[model samples]
Target: MFRRIKITLSLLLTLSLLLIYLPQSLPIAGAAAAGQASQIDAVLVVDVSNSMNTSDTDKIGNEAMKMFIDMLSTKGDKVGIVAYTDKVQREKALLEIQSPSDKEDLKKFIDGLDRGPYTDTAVGITEAMKVLQHGADPNHEPMIVLLADGNNDFAKNSGRTQSQSDKEMAQAVQEAKDAGIPIYTIGLNADGKLNKQALEDLANETGGKSFSTNTADDLPQILSEIFASHLKLKVVPIQSMTGNGKFQEVTINVPNASVLEANISIMSSKPVETVLVDPTGTEVAVPSDNVLLSKSKSYSLIKLLTPAEGDWKLKVKGASKDKIDINLVFNYDLELAIDPIPSKTYKTGDKIDIRASLTSNGQQLPNTELYTNMNAVLVVKDLDSSKTEEIKLTNTGDSFEGSYTIADKHEYELTVRAEEKSFYRETEPVTVSAKGTTSSSGSAGVTTPKPADVEKEDAKPFPVMLTIIWGLIIATLLGAAILIMKMIQKANKGFVGQLVIEIRDENTNEKTFPQYKKLGAFKGKFNLHQLLQLAPELKETEGFIFIPGSNDRIIIRSQNGGTLEKSGRAVDISKGLELKSGDRITVPLSQADKTIFLEYLV
Candidate 1:
């Protein structure tokens, strides 16, 4: 009985050892529980721009917030909130709880947010940093998740320009980087016109990831994946190529885990030779070596050398068979090229004839069949209307010509794309101006008026013309009455003639007289000839004349003889001279002297 009991005890001990040592095949109870221990601290910065006031933005925000809260709650971690507009209005403390709480506070904050007219992202980041600095402990990893629909337009003070705001915001980001904070940015727009580049830079600098979202509905799933599988993947070497004009052997190494299988394949713009080998140094079936591996395996070697130089892709499928997880790496080599082909520009209802010659490195390619596989798009946009038209090209060997007629005047840009194998070259831009046709009237050959002349003719002339006629009539009546009264008194008024004089003042340089035209009376319009007569001293070289009420003297010169036509217009000259009791008028002479042109009727 003692011998039998000893054998039975040894068998039980052996069974317990098998359960403890071989955990992979055994039913492990706490394997998932071990994974839950590692948690991360996440901060979400959301944009509440006026443009994001739609139901889509609200739904995405709510769903993403719910997922984040759920994940963090499960991990017993803390999550913070920052609701931003043109300014950061509401912020919540990082809530750390042992049990999941209803997201009432977060929902309330989101509901109360008022969509702002503008965005000031710099201020929002500063506010977020304050919350993060206070909430994050030294032991936990801190990450910032930024969501924005627009660029940074935060101003230091009122009246700041866009460029000034950009500079301030860039400095603020640099400050955050210095404080050891990592930022993960998400662009919610497809075109990425906003602060996308800035957000990407923030992510790269802070050792965080950047993601782009095309549709708002994809946000929840993407965020969930981010939280669930937050593993950091670092590519070793990052680049590898086959040598010796053929693909013969290739190798890849993954640290921290043994590689179970690796399958390699090559793709190029042009066909070339290829060969592949497995990890066990065994040759696999090379059914058309150009295509390479097609199965899931532990190790693979690819050998390929391409003839064309454009873009090439090498796909590497690797699996950690020991862990039952697979990983993939894609290697890309893109070549650069230059091709000269004159693209065509066309208007609607007009036909386009396109002719092109393709050459590379100063050598013309062989007589290859020209494929007219091109797509043409026409976008017409104005203040009140917009329309778009898409046209597909038909294959025409060597050369292609087509016509399109346009109905209205517009500015258009045409793009032509040519592809051969993996090589593609886009032609330079072509602009087409399409305007409605004009009909000729009579034999005048389409008389089109100059824009400037048309504008001048359109100006109103009623006010100016009436004023001139009235002033001329009044001046004529007054001059006739004064002359008749003076003649009756036998006043010795001087005859009309050119009188030249030079006058100077203490302060400024002399200026030339401007031409003024005079009509029939003092109230009549003064022409250029009258202006010369009034300042005859201007006729002499370097001589100047000063009118009574004017501030500056005017220089005058004569091109022909000093004689010039004078108007019969008259004016009172009593204020500008020290007249004698019998003097009616005084005139300035060429000798820097004053002469009486008319005697006063005493």
Candidate 2:
């Protein structure tokens, strides 16, 4: 058979060189286990005072919060809305629910909320903890959802009485339980002037939960059981077994949807013996009845409601040698993106093209190996000389392209990362437009000093001993006339010479380019990247003026705190500021772009 066709063509040439030298840094276990994600920041403290305007309970609290924002899951929650009375407004800010036109414009902005007159309920839980600490997404995991129908009355219409508004609503319920943030209240007690024990102490003081409706058809099953007890979707992972007492199993599969709410948890630093086996084999403690059993000093939570979708078994039985951990959450929806949307103006050598697209519960999902499964990075910042630039983005298939350059006029601050699974940073300052160079060689320790020129040391040739140089120049001109008369009596009112910076335009004084830099000597250290390479137009800056004691011109505009020492050491002028000769500083950039300078070391 011709030697069996030369052993099948040498085994197909060793499987074509192992698929062409495979090794794109291997390990991609299903795109890194499908990029695990489960963030969550939900906030919604409605009330609309005037006592829920005589009970439609604000239209049943806007149809149970638009059916709990249409069962949220744009890859694990993100929502906001405040609407209080007796103060606190913030209508919408923490967004990220990526589509369905953002839950239909947040249910038409919660049906055009309007009813304020008085009812503080602790200023709507401190403005939903200040919109989850200023518009969520800083590692998510904050929740509020309150709905109140009265209580904490704005003390006699804003005067402070009712035991000082129930002791500041129990100190805003212990600052949302010391920021482990959980509220979930909701009580519209149909006209009986709701309050229901301050909404059950703001949902039992934090571990959330406390619902009441009284009419409007029980507000959609109590806001769908408070969003099915704070939705989660899927997390599964905690499979282990070794010594310390036997039986350890995990099988979980669950998915044939219709309100799952499965759960599992176990912890140990010492006592363990968890057993949860269901899937038609019996033995359970939370298989329904919307169960809930919590514990904390280490962990032990159980909350199954209708969990049965096949292969579910979990058992752990330990006693000593520490090791018993299992945690599985389920609510569902995670995502990822990077698409063709990178323009607001890009032209100092452009080559952008960053792609983004992949939806988890909304389902678009095929990234087709967006760069052998992820790792990109392309930050760029200038924000008037804080100058940063981190680039890596290379993948060009499912999208990511690179090419960058900026010469001047920049306020850019773009970010795009993936690794820790898709993150997107933003700061709002993307201008970019300085190609023919007016400034900005792209930072890495910026430098632009070859033109503030000053080179004049060439007129010296008279050394012919004229009578022993006229008696050593008459005793060196009498010690230079007593050090120029003590430096002109300590130059008490300006005029020494050599520190000239002057970049105007503090709102049309218009000058920023009459370039003058003679900062030759103030005696070292004016750091701060040499004052941003000597006035690359300083803006929105922080302060500094420490030649402090030796001259006493200490300025302080820290807006928060100040400390920028000098002659007694401790310098890091945060990019520069220390003037003398009638100093007249003003820095303030970004949308009013001002710099107003005057420093004169003379």
Candidate 3:
């Protein structure tokens, strides 16, 4: 009987999990077999920064993209162009590739494009996303294929932090992920100075892949990989289970799945911990190498290329206190791949070779046409010396090659011009810093602190109302002190009597002892806590003791030399202080204690 019950319980658990599947109650493979998916819309976001123009990344990228478009048999598929520098410029609006002729317009758009001043990648991504909404096939899922050669230089131009740039990118990626869109990023060269890791991180967070190439000639092959394998995926939506308070748990059931990609976002500002549990009931490790930490571990995005099919559970903590939860689910996504790797970085004295990678949207141009269709010019400038020179670079193949010597120990700006188009990269501008030179300034030698601030004009006077109020307060106090001293000298204060204090209930008309208090909350209690409220000076004691002087005059002095008043007038009681019968004594309380009251045996 015990064995049967255990078996029954196990069966019930499995049955409960079966309900975790999508509302359709069918597997993804089964859905795909049903033939429901349609065209996938893609946005081509190009970096029109100076670096792309100078390094020929823009030219190579254009040829590579046009070749990829030619290879794609996307009959009804739509593609849009998003070119950006400091802002987004939608060159060719979202257009469908109805026939082979539409490819030429796109090629022309890429060929005629020019470089912009700064790199606003986040702005480009955001604007590109909006472009996907117009004239888009409702059945298609949108994707952004972004290519960047350098880091976002908008920080220096806009006078904001790189963190703001990072946050903006993260937010845009999150928005894409929420809309079931994936972002595939291609980085030309992000060697810390260019922020290549940020591109990789954004890709990871969005369940997308990051590609990189050092040279411009090999960029077209990267573009080819994105178009060659157009994997069509069906969107699966499962019933969501809600959890609360720190560690919220949710399960994503990917039945008969080959690839699993997910984005987990905490609906909170505070950082949270997101852990994944496989179908085998074992917790998956947070791979430090694969994770992209944005804004200091605030975003948790994980991508699983080959996931085990079972009940994949997502566990999140940190948002429980705020009633915030994590949004985690499997989204259909893909990434671009780079080929022919190991692109080199050229220095000041090193010669850089630019070759025959130029192509319009139609065909790849040959190296011989470089002289007629394009001419390369290299301009170098030393900021410290304010010296500059322009030299004609020689074309190697479909590219140009040039070399220069570092003669000045100052920052430099290297620009490339081809066919009346000038290209400039925002990354380390002509970074040929002189050896053995040190300064208390930031990289780029732009921001430096001053030794002294410039002097300003003298401060003006206070307001008239403020000046009059302060003057009256000082004069009144001085006048009262003089009057008190004069009266003390003339009055006779030699009378004697025993000092006594009479206590009466202000509301009840009944006399009470010193320890009595109206402790309504703790009524019928004669506790020392009540006595402390009456005479706080006897803070640690339960009672007070006083002795009368031989003379009837009573003197009260403050230990801290604080001011005291009688009948709203200042008193010089510190010098031979005296009091009389029926004289009510009221002592002001310190900031930390309540006011006290006494009577001279009236």
Candidate 4:
């Protein structure tokens, strides 16, 4: 019995020794076996706009590139370079650096960068996405670093406008957001002020972060920090228990955490505890007080937990100072509905019938009041005169119906604004044409035809009389056709006679034409040549002629002191003379004589 007890004690001592030593040894062994999987696939999108030529911008670019290279060197990660201005140029993969040995080549690429005339951020982002999607592993976390020194410059080119560029950039950002790709934006110089808000919006939408750098020197550190703090993990519960039950062994699988520290939180009625277990079935005690996460490597582990369940929530919060709020919900289902009918088409003066119904789980909700506001108005406009009238809507029962008068013939736009509780809904504009009637004259005149006089005595027509009546009708039709042709010819003549004149600067040769309609009048100085051009009749006179339409009528003094007098009525020639380049004319009224400067003489 003594020997047996001694043997049992020896075995127990051996087991405890194994438990303590194996736990620490197994983790090291497993870590070695898993190898280093913290490979960062990053794309650098640089803005080469002219504004980047500023001292601050250059510093930012240089620093950002340097920081990126240093981070890659430490982690042996893959990095691609995309330089963008009006267009995007991607560095060849062979030229890119994925290891420390390729740092020289990467430095060369960064140093060779030149500023472009315009900035096209959208194009840059799109190209970056293409590079990341095609070049990087889909299973890996992909990040894009976009640097810009100007507003969306892609728009100001000779071919495109600013508004168009904004739209394209917005679309590119949205696409990146949809793809679950994070974008880190660095705005340099004034570019930050111009596009900071937009960059923040993109970052918020795409689960990324944005920073502004006044100088290029700040870029490298910022980028280094960004890459050094990246993390990606896939969280899943091994077993789930609902409504008050102890969950047995909830495991979380972490895939990567190169630049981030992750904390796994298991919420239950009781505070849950976490234990790191190795493959050898030995418990590893983690430093419960504090842990330092690595910047150049990733750690993966399976978390085990046992918790009493009553609507339990498991969350993994990224541990980084600049970390954005990433809310991940599991196993969710959603239903959407619109109050009133989802769609309708109505004409002006017609009542728009709207009914409420909710579409959920393939069923229509009828009991819900779906309370909606009825103060929305539909504005109908006469397309010709642009006359518009607003019609208010009111709900009757479950349907809201309202009528508006069809004031004129037009394609009426029916817009419905409905608010159900806190949700707001708007229907797309529905186009309905207002019926229009034509008169006999066919000049866009709407008039009803009068009934024939029934009290007039009926006269019997002879065959010759009937023939004569038919001939007159044919003659009238022929005359109408001739009249139409003449009118068309006159219109063509008028159009051909109209002239456009451009006045050019004598020194700079810059030309400008006065928009008489906008200014109503012109102001400036004139010369002899301008005066002569304004009054061509002065050419007949030696050197000069009288200034027409001047309040103080001044005689045009010739070199010989001879005053040139008007030979004919100036009004006739004035009416025929079309304004052209360098013309100096004036408008004279009896009440108030106003001198007008004519930039154009035709």
Candidate 5:
């Protein structure tokens, strides 16, 4: 019995030691999975000409615009509106959507849109660009969506002539292209009088899409497509329903946690009601903290914020004869990255292979059904001629691969764009120089210099004296850099002013006088032993160190057994807490005994 008791105690001792020495690891999985979402700034340039009054007698365009506004997430996305005829008629500066109230206000503004006498497409485009230029976010992706009949109508005595207006329009489009802002054009061809070619030119020149429809009723669908394309998302079609005045249930998968938002749009001839059931079989209430429901005359939209990863059930109710079409657009926080190019230069006619992949939480996404429907393309641009070309890529299980042939000797910029039925991503542009047979000036033929001229250029003597002079200059600069580095190192070894400290007892409410000590007197680290000399009453403090940090700040590092606080909030001092001037820190000297109060006086 004695031997067995001793063995049991030894095992417990070993376990205690292991616990004391084990490293503490934080739970970091999925903590950085969904990073910050990129913001979007969009401008709606609408043509409210007299022709629109006839082409859209019911003002369906207004309803479409309102739907587009409702689709925007309350995630700091900005929007502007420009209604124009021969000149700017009404304008709304860029407004950020922070809540449901902001979207309602914007829709109300769209409701008051009135028709004007004539249409000058140039005026509409320019005023929209002006609104963006005045109040655009530098970090946001900016775009302009123009809705027009594409007619160039100017009343007599209007300040601008047709030729001048055309010139201004061309210049404005070029400016937008230079600023990397795409102009999406929606042409209403209800009367078959739409200037189709004009609208296409505007979109094609600025890397945007041109959409047209013959019936005004199609305006809402077109608007939804434009909104999705502009934000690199896709319009996923759900089941179409023939309502029977009873609630019908449909199941939709939320897919993955990378999705930042899921906007489900229900388009119908009349307003339909909806109810949502989450994956856990819990009924989700509309207008709650995580769900937003927007209803209009022709549509009802439900936006789910950071939806759970699983299947979701949605119930819909409408009139007996109503037709309801449902669709979903998912906004993801995943990033697509292209592998680095093997070389920075290539010969003409060489085939360059590109590979790209998707990542969330900085980890590559595995091969799954998500890549089966994805489309990848390589966009090549000539640096000198400003020409662009797209090459399609195939999905190779978990990655995308494609090859492009270099046809000229000029420098080219390359970007890989990968898109799925739900979201799209593009990489930053990379440059590569191609050298061979083609002329840089884009001429039909290449011209080669004569052998005699090449020999003459090669025969020139090397400048030894100039080389030596440059070598000495570089040496001098390197010495100066080394000297400056040493000075900076020396300056960081000490800090100004002393640390003032006080001790207080929690059980007895006893206090101690203030004690001051120069932090520079201790080299490298200030341990508890050094501090105990200044105030012997603070003997309870152990395993604490103070190090001089940059900018007159002191770093406080603590071990186990006490709590550190700043202004009544617990401070995590396991790593270090930077205490600046005028900041006060308190650490309990024991579990239920005295406390140490510290402040830096500079």
Candidate 6:
């Protein structure tokens, strides 16, 4: 009878668990789109302490800063500069690069940079992050480039000790990591007395690369490499030219139609003149319809936009003693995507299968030769412990694949990066949780306890009263489980997920945080006016409405006298428009001088 009671209790507990977790097990309709950036936002943080007067007397660092700015796309990439000693001496807010004039403005700022008396690496990084925090766009990728020659050397009057500076630096780095920003560091070891480990730690802790140089003259090449790597591009070497005051021709192959821009960089002590000819043997004029030319004392950059796919000829001329080095950095509109996971639930010891591929122009990369020299790796980070692990992946002709066993009972972020000798690309991060060894957290499935052995003497006849109580308990749990299953089905059909929103006051140059609005609880129309409390200026426009649609989509409608847009194209929502996950909707309030951006996510 004791054994019978134990079995009855076990059955009751099992039914209770089913009632509690049934709703959570319901399948979500679709996955959210990967958070890929449409453009880039970068900050250059330079150390200008008195020690730099010995290391970078030639100020090649300034020229490198100019070259890096010149390489940004003219289609809205933004950049800022910060020069620091014990504190921030000079700074510029992020400025969008929309034309040649914008590039010149940033270069002019770089030219005005000078040295200060003390050094404080933490101050430089902190100020750079502050600049990005105020101006960075949610749709853009953000990064920081830091150059330092020595360690922290605070003045007595600065009121900052090494320990205090270190603490602030740690907090700043954590904030950058949380925001998905990487800080690339460059250490100048001109005197062989640089703090290499400090710079390397800053980079490694935030998913970035660290570079060291013995001479400031190498700054330009390192900067170029950093710019290319940050944008997932390849800087292909063309050839080294020995000048004889005559034009020499070189053939450049635009491998495929996917190439968006081919930036040809020529580096030498003196300027090298260049002429271009198309694949059809027709001479293309310099600085013409689609070509842009930028020249400095150390280098010349010729940018070709949407060039034809074939071998093109470039002619270069320089003085007899000039030794010019040429490199081609091709920027393509490509995406690295990770295939969907089979299970929505993850747990410690679970083996996850990761597969990723490259795509361009809405098509998978077709050439298998492109994968010959490529390598891929999986990066996983534990947000709770701040620990990271990397797993190497194998190339499978057309895609990359690997497997990773979850090792901890914590939330982990997974990202895959594929690279070759000259270029690398990474997918946006995906998050998963591993709830191991059922604990009090109630995050994992229930563990059943075995019934203990019962002595024959103790196994007496069961009481009739106990039997009735046991029967009632079983009936109650079973009924609850059935109701939970029904609720799960209803919720699945009504779910529309949520929207992540941000608002900007263009006139005042003020912005709001990225916040979420829940829509899953609404069955019909969701009014945009409901969010006015978060952004009071939103009250200026007629409210927007969203209703449920078929096949995991929402229908959007605008009220009278309101303007709506998608990707800069006006949306005629009078008849209602269907939008799926990953769609961004824009509403402009001319009266209030503000704009609201909404992104749908599941």
Best model per TM-score: 5
Score candidate 5 by TM-score against the native.
0.62
Backbone clashes in candidate 2 total 17
Please give the TM-score that candidate 1 achieves against the real structure. Answer: 0.32
lDDT of 4 by residue, 202-286 (tens): 6777888888766554454455446544532222224433322222343433221111223332222223333443334454454
Task: Name the lDDT value of residue 409 in candidate 2.
Answer: 55
Candidate 1 lDDT over residue span 1-602, tens digit each: 99657645554554454465566675565533322223456677887766565424444654555544543422235566776766665565555433323344444455565566557666667666766664454545566777776465444466756776567667757766887677777677744455567778767876667777766655644554445333221112224343334333334332111121122323221233433343354444554433233221212223221212222333332222221111232221111112222233324565444433333332333433323332322222321234545444433454333433444556555445444321233444455554433322232254668998889888857588788986775566456545555543432221221233223322353432321111111111112223233223333422222121112111122333232112333433222222222333323334433222323221
Candidate 4, which segments miss by more than 4 Å at Cα?
1-36, 55-57, 73-76, 89-98, 154-157, 190-193, 232-602
Model 2 scores a TM of 0.27
Question: lDDT of model 1 at residue 392?
Answer: 42
Q: Estimate each model's TM-score.
A: 0.32, 0.27, 0.33, 0.33, 0.62, 0.61
**Residue 240 in model 3: lDDT:** 31
- Model 3's number of clashes is 13
For model 1, the local distance difference test gives 0.43
* Sliding window of 10 residues with minimal summed lDDT for model 6: 28-37
Candidate 6 RMSD to the correct structure: 14.3
- What would the per-residue lDDT of candidate 3 be over residues 1-602, giving only the tens digit for each residue? 99657645554554444445337555444323222223557888888888675555336666655554543332556777788886764345565675546766677677777887777788778767666643355566567788886476763647766677667877788788887777888887623245578788877777677788766555544554454223422223233333354566777654433233443333333566678777888877775433322222222334453466667887766643443433333322221111121133323453333222233222334434333334556667777878879777675555555655656444556655444111111111334444434432334445544544322222444479987986775555445545544544433223233233334444455654432111111211122322232233434322222222344444554333444456666665434335556565544444424434555542
| CA lDDT scores, all candidates in order | 0.43, 0.56, 0.51, 0.45, 0.79, 0.79
Q: Is candidate 3 or candidate 4 better by lDDT?
A: 3
Candidate 5: deviation at residue 562, Å?
A: 62
* lDDT per residue as tens, model 2, 505-591: 656677744333333222212322233332223433423332222353432224333333334444444444455665544434443
The residue ranges of model 3 lying beyond 4 angstroms of the native Cα positions read 1-38, 155-160, 190-194, 229-602
* Comparison by TM-score, 3 against 5, better one: 5
Query: Judged by lDDT against the true structure, how good is candidate 4?
Result: 0.45
